[model samples]
Target: MGDKLSLPLKPFRSRGGVKAPHRKHTAECESVVMPPPSEVLICMSQHIGVPCKPVVKPGDEVKVGQIVGDNDAFLSVPMHSSVSGRVKKIETVTMPNGSKVQAVRIESDGQMTPFEGIKPPKIETRDDFIKAVRDSGVVGLGGAGFPVHVKIGVERDKVDTLIINAAECEPYITADNREALENSWGVVSGIKAVMELMEIDRAIIGIENNKPNAIKVLNEVCREANRDMHGNVCVLPLKARYPQGAEKVLIKVCTGRVVPEGKLPADVGCVVMNIASIAFVSSYLKTGMPLVTKRITVDGSAVNRPQNVIVPIGTRIKDIIEFCGGYKCRPEKIIFGGPMMGLALPDDEMPLLKQNNAVLAFSEKEAARLEPSDCIRCGRCAAACPMGLTPPLISGLVAKGDAEGLADNGIMVCMECGCCAFACPANRPIVQNMRMGKSIVRSAKKK
Candidate 1:
């Protein structure tokens, strides 16, 4: 379900994750537009593919939605300026992945001016739709950051069903929920547009049963659609479970289809897009604006105001914290997403990326770490893993440097969803070991 899973493997546990607490603190707080950050650091490598090269040099005045970084790579999408300002400088910055890429620092003029070149795309054909999607800079808004255009640009016959993922199962994240409630029409219009352009058979919008309001709003919108816009789209309420929002997990639960390892949803006659991503498509098609802002939930024990804020891309985490009434206490950990699979940034200086759905800051007590104890071999980790892989086995292989065994056991298939770590009474760092084991297997392959 995660990007780390690539190897083909045997059947996995259809349901093998923990029922984590749904810390939907800001579920009812409608999203508010955050004032533009004094400065923004737009990264060149926002998506999963090749990093975009800078198209604007320092001292150039650019407006919102202006193309600032771009690459010709099919897997890549253009990066646009989130604010109207002068490019202060272009500097090589370290990304969370430990790689360095050029980052454009822009001094926002506070006017929130738009680029004159912003325009709605003409979409008469499927190619036009795909191109428009790419031009809109839409990616996986659910935190995958994969280029949406490249994913749905396959043959018309390849995808039979289009799945809209409205299941925001992760804790402390309600951006999708807000989108469903506020932009129900946008979500439905997006689905209708995609289905028409791609010639897909039907569309299913999956929302967890936990959010009855979101589900109800979506169903009402779909039900009240004009007669010509009816029946092709429907809503399905799913059991709320952690990692239920994972692409493959949602697909299986919604369609009873298991995307084989090393394959994509398209291989199984399906395409999955995040709820917010598709809603943005409808908005972009009308406004011609690229994805320059994001609606993110800001919460945790350390935050003063726990609510959703629509922020410009590249706004620093510190600024966002300030906007959210600042910290109630000194944060020991600042995560860029949900606690389960979110990344803990080194500091608040980091800029928000395209896929960041939530910013969670926890105090030392809330973020406390427990020392790992000897495994009791109770198999909780094994039972908790969605892939049914043995976490202890992987950890042992990583410790013994047995890359062969790790690879044979589908080490790469570990999505690092952290279910094992969460379920382990021993507090074992199984996900960390999986990351290490994956590195060893990668090294072995390269050797």
Candidate 2:
């Protein structure tokens, strides 16, 4: 491994990251559960693994938490029905990235019924605990849809620390913060469960210092549960910073450990999980209900009402907006997550996925980008890159289609967190170029 593949020990700090506006309008708003949508277009590829195959055909009846899609692949987790309904049709739908994926549309009966066979799984053994998590269908609920079970199902001896990411670093996203406030017990219990079952000795809950309420509540709850927990648990208050919630950055900040390139947190003797994901593990272990509904922050300048709500995983974007009193004005752009590192949606009719933590509708003033000017040899982009990547160099290589050159310069290490784009005085599309450079490098490697 090269220098870029490691973290600096003497520094005891992670590299460059940017600070953005903290537009947390709904940070104090409690989450309300939205009524079931008329129908849900549940996609098969919600997680960052193999896309599941639809097991139930059109017209098949289903209850909430019933398996609708599954795959034999080890990386994939089973997908559950979000509402009691009948499958309308199985069709291929285009995602925000313009890739087509199979989706199952279900006509909701509004019954809100749970599956008849729902019950908590037995967890007498470590394998039992892993199986329960896999059956729960939870994933990285903060934003990335990495399967949760796959993260926990690692070699026991390889891991000694479990890090819970409660740092909702992105602006306008308070869903995770609410989780810490509303269900602090769940957060503590979930951490203890993982630590006990996995035999981990240390657990850290990383929260941005801006969320003092969340930090207060979580610390109180963890203290209350100190006698019940198997190992030590600390609620570490992190400095408020963008990309603070990113796994790699969180690992470095919380534990001073660096995850090597092409490796995972577990490789560095740690397991990092999103706050909501771990909370869901506790809920599922108690109630046996799988992941179907997700908490979302509905806000932005275009929103009529900025609030937090819990909606079914497959609810349409427009429906969620309507539930929030519709738009304040015509939205020029709709983003899936936060302003930074979020995907722009081509259509709002597309259903919500498991990983989406926020639905942002932006007015023209907020969404419009300044015309990019020539790079003036300014190093702000490099200074802001969390992975120490030079976006200008990567952009040049991408323009020339020099994939090997991009690879040699550690372009693949770029996390696409948009720190460069946010820091650029020239308004350059460096993050987009970084994406292209990584794509080009990946394609060349495939060849």
Candidate 3:
């Protein structure tokens, strides 16, 4: 196993990403728990794939960890109640992604009662492991919302590397960093658990150089646990760059493996999981508490306190902001997640989803609309794309409604990290057009 540790530390390079301002205001703030909101709005479609159907009706009593909605689809996972409450209603609500999803509204009884069936799973086989993961209700906590059970259930022989993504590279988000520093044991345990269950011997925890404290803490934990004795559990420091935490980018930086176009990390002998997601695995295996609460960084120019807080899942954005001391100035734009990849919310009424990591409130000055101009053709957008995409060309095709041309140029490969738009001198909405191009391709394929 010690021999497996021989993989050399790869040089950290820019890799076409920009040097955006980190603005990690809450990096030093320890997370504090926020009281449960008076009510919760748990959306059934939090995970990718088919939306769950409500299992409990409007007058039903629910306990924490009780499954409220579920679906039999192979790609879907169940939703659990975050608080002991009575179901108020089940209705359709609009999400930040512009999709209307069925959400279960629960009026809290103020008593956090655990479900009677909440107990640690007895995992003696691979099937048991998968079932436990599904029951835990874990997903990609870094904002992707892909079901974790489906990811780990990939054929074992094809996966040789497990990458723990701790590179919270997005600006204004520090939830993953704080988790790495404070829950080092849980992080290592989670990594080991996956490695053993999947029969993988090599694992890498990738943290950006910006988070020196997290890197140092994780390394120390690995050494104490002797994780390197049985398998390679190395902490690889990444160059501090925007979109550095992207799955494809992180795989390339950590394992020197390039995920081919229209493929997944598993297709290249790797599986990437967020650090916080792995930590939750460690916690759930011990306490049997499902994914019900989340640690989120509440910050931005308009936030009054701007701190990291732990709140129940389905907690409304308005309640969380109020807990953070409300707005210092009237917020002009509210974003869920980091500025680079987060979705802008029309209002603060939306409840926090399983994938949400931060809620950024920008004042009018910070959220000032920038006028777009003709492309300068300066090539900055291409140079700044971490995926090495020519945004100007793809965006032009999208504007002309040339979905076929966009697909020929690999438009679907764009992760829409907003680097191209951020680097454009003319302030063009390159990512927005790229998104439109992708939607066109997807809708055509579906048809």
Which of 1 and 2 is the better model by TM-score? 2
* Cα RMSD (angstroms) for every candidate in the order listed: 4.6, 3.5, 1.7
Regions of model 2 farther than 4 Å from truth: 1-12
Instruction: Report the C-alpha lDDT of model 2 over 110-140, residue by residue, as the tens digit.
Output: 9989999999888999999988888888888
What TM-score does structure 2 among the candidates reach? 0.96
lDDT of 1: 0.88
Put the candidates in TM-score order, highest first: 3, 2, 1
- Model 3, 419: alpha-carbon shift in Å? 0.4
- Model 2 is weakest, by summed lDDT over 10 consecutive residues, at 1-10
RMSD of 1: 4.6
Which candidate model has the greater lDDT, 1 or 3? 3
Q: Least accurate stretch of 10 residues (summed lDDT) in model 3?
A: 1-10
What is the Cα-based TM-score of model 3? 0.97
Per-residue lDDT of 199-268 in model 3, one digit per residue for the tens? Answer: 8768888888999988889989987766454637888988898888999999888877789999988999
